[model samples]
Target: MMASVYDIWGAGFETTVATLQFAIIYLLNYPEVQRKLHEEMDGVIGREQELTMDDQKRLPYLCATIQEVQRASNVAPINFVRTTTEDIVVAGYLLRKGMNVIPQMPSLHLDDKLFPDPERFDPKRHLDKQGNFVKSDYVMPFSLGKRACMGESLARMELFLFLGTMVQKCEFQSVDKDAPPKIAVTP
Candidate 1:
């Protein structure tokens, strides 16, 4: 029971906290993004009300920002190290059973071809020309597929709720805008 409990906390809660820290730091550094979140929340959900999953549809920029945070933070450095169950052809080479493979998440998240100007931290990247929140399969913060992180949906909901609520209530500010925090990319 204790081992299971610890696994849940270590795998999910800790990573979520780290991701949230990155988001808060980014919000502090980029006031414009913060303003956009505030505006969206106020316009769509209002200050007094709790934001729902339904409200997420109306807040494109905020949702994008959350995605950007997840991508940028790369909190879960190693996501579901996988092994082949049986012999399979992968892109030509045969991957036999017992061969271990891990997705290099940062490589995918920071790919210039997939995300133009990848280092800019621009949430607008996730937006379509129609100004809709478009999700990218490439943004695999919680990994992907059947063997992906167990807490993925829970993490996402937590991110939206906590971040939405916090931004709805308080404004984040940087004491020195010129010397904003330089968050390290976790390996």
Candidate 2:
């Protein structure tokens, strides 16, 4: 039982941390996005009390921002390769039963066809014209199907609560005013 707990925490909690770091990076890069986040947090999860998952409904922009962070962050760039249990045809390609299926989840998140202008870190993409959070089916940050990340819901909840609460009280800014914040690429 303890091992299971440790394993889940190591995998799940670490990814949440990564997502939060990415959120901070993006927030620093885009002050306008940070300002909007502050506005939403102020309106919904004010300084009076701590934010809970229940407040998520009232914070559509916060939710959309988190979704955008997850989409752009691409924490788990590649998913655990799963083998086909039986012969299957996907995208007009047939795969043998025992063939290993390597799913590159980032492909979906960064796909221009699914998400228009996939390069931009605009949370508005996750929101509808009416300003409501329109959860996109293509936002497969946690991936899709049976072998998807087990801690997806937990990660989302933690991101929303922790990021929401942090952004509510504090204002983040970049050190250099003139130059944009740089995102380092690493394996």
* Inter-residue clash pairs, candidate 2: none
lDDT of 2 by residue, 39-88 (tens): 88877667877888888888899999999988888888887888899999
Q: What RMSD does each model have against the real structure?
A: 1.7, 1.6
The reply for model 1, stretches above 4 Å from the true place, is none
lDDT against the true structure, per candidate, is: 0.86, 0.85
- For residues 70-116, could you state the per-residue lDDT of candidate 1 as single tens digits? 88878876766788888999779999999998877988888898988
Measured on C-alpha atoms, candidate 1 has an lDDT of 0.86
Instruction: Report the C-alpha displacement of residue 18, candidate 1, in angstroms.
Output: 0.6
Error of 1 at 140 (Å): 0.8
Please name the candidate that would achieve the greatest lDDT relative to the true structure. 1
TM-score of each: 0.91, 0.94
